[model samples]
Target: MQSIERAFDLLELMADAGGEVALSELAETSGLPLPTIHRIMRTLVSSGYARQQPSRRYSLGPRLIRLGETASRSLGSWARPYLAELTEATGETSNMAVLDGDQVVYVAQVPSQHSMRMFTEVGRRVDAHATAVGKAVLADLAADSVAQLLERSGMRAQTERTITSVGAMQDELARIREQGYAVDDGEREVGVRCYAVALPGAPAGAAISISGPEGRMTRMSTDTLVPLMQRLAEKLAAELRTASHGA
Candidate 1:
């Protein structure tokens, strides 16, 4: 048990250092003796779960990707039915995305039924600042974290409606949080509008969105759609919460 705790402490220390740790740094961070850390690091490196850099620092290795893939698969499987229901209700594209760094990566999507629909492939990645789902999740984060993410993302305008100023984006996020949903308003792509609702208790950066062409989505009354969307979101959220508890 003590060995396991030491190993986890070392891993956390390395993660906190942005994925790399020198032997001395690891020992200092974990409060473990140098010899103990060296032995654990040797085992971790030999198992391909950690790698030694040319500078002799250790970092997370490719084995973590397999664990990430497994988690992503579980997330997608749990979200699929909700995505289908969303597509059926709105006749628009429905997507489930999780924030990755400063980007929102589409893990699953239910394509629109219309002949002329906005098509985004699964596994596509978009700037978090440019997408409704991205904003919905970002709104839940702290102001400092949001600022850091924006700085990392570098606001690149994708369309005429994209929010270009940090002040403007902050104001928009405030509104999104107040309304319990986020709107794209043709921000990410010309003639495209998106509406997103964040799922509470989700792993950070998780959100769901429905998107369609502005002509159709903009013309629809929010009074009519908002209630329906909220209901669906509630149901989806409940299911996700239940599944998470069971897991």
Candidate 2:
């Protein structure tokens, strides 16, 4: 059990350092002796979870991709019922997304009964600056962290409404913080608008959103929908916490 914990700690330390680190860096950060760290890393490398670079730096290996994708799919499946409930209540497409690196990846969705409703593919990755879910999650992060993320992923305009400047994004995030939700006003797509709220206690940065055409979304009363979304997010977070505890 101790070895397992140590291995995971090293992996997380490497991830925190942007997926690669020197052996000494892991020792310094983890306070583990060099020999112990080396033994654990060797086990991870042999098990295909980590790789040693030519520079002798350790990096996460490609094998973890399969594990990550499968876990994401499982999470999406588990959240579908919640998203379906949101869609049924709002009469719009509902989606759950998580912050992945500097992008927001859609993990689950329940399309509206309306034939012309908004729809996003489950695995689709969108720039954080352009989506309501992205903004909702980013709003919870520190200003410096948000700036670093934006600097890593350039704020390219997806539509005329997209916030392109860091100052403007900070302002938008401030508004989201004040309002308790975020809105994508034709930002990601020319005619689509979305409303999102951050999940209260997700293991990672996550948000749920309701999206539709500009006309329908604009006509909806945010005063009514935002609170409903917030309640659902809290409920979902509670369930996730329970499950994690059980595990």
Among all windows of ten consecutive residues in candidate 1, which has the lowest summed lDDT? 12-21
lDDT (C-alpha) at residue 246 in model 2: 89
Model 2 agreement with the true structure over 16-119: per-residue lDDT tens digits: 56688899999999999999999999999999999999999999988987987887797788788888888988899999998876788898999999989998
Candidate 1 pairs with clashing backbones? none
- Which TM-score value belongs to model 2? 0.88
Model 2 per-residue lDDT at 122: 92
Per-candidate TM equals 0.79, 0.88
The C-alpha lDDT values of all candidates are: 0.81, 0.90
Q: For residues 171-242, could you state the per-residue lDDT of candidate 1 as single tens digits?
A: 999998888888998888988999888877664468888889899998866676666666766676677778
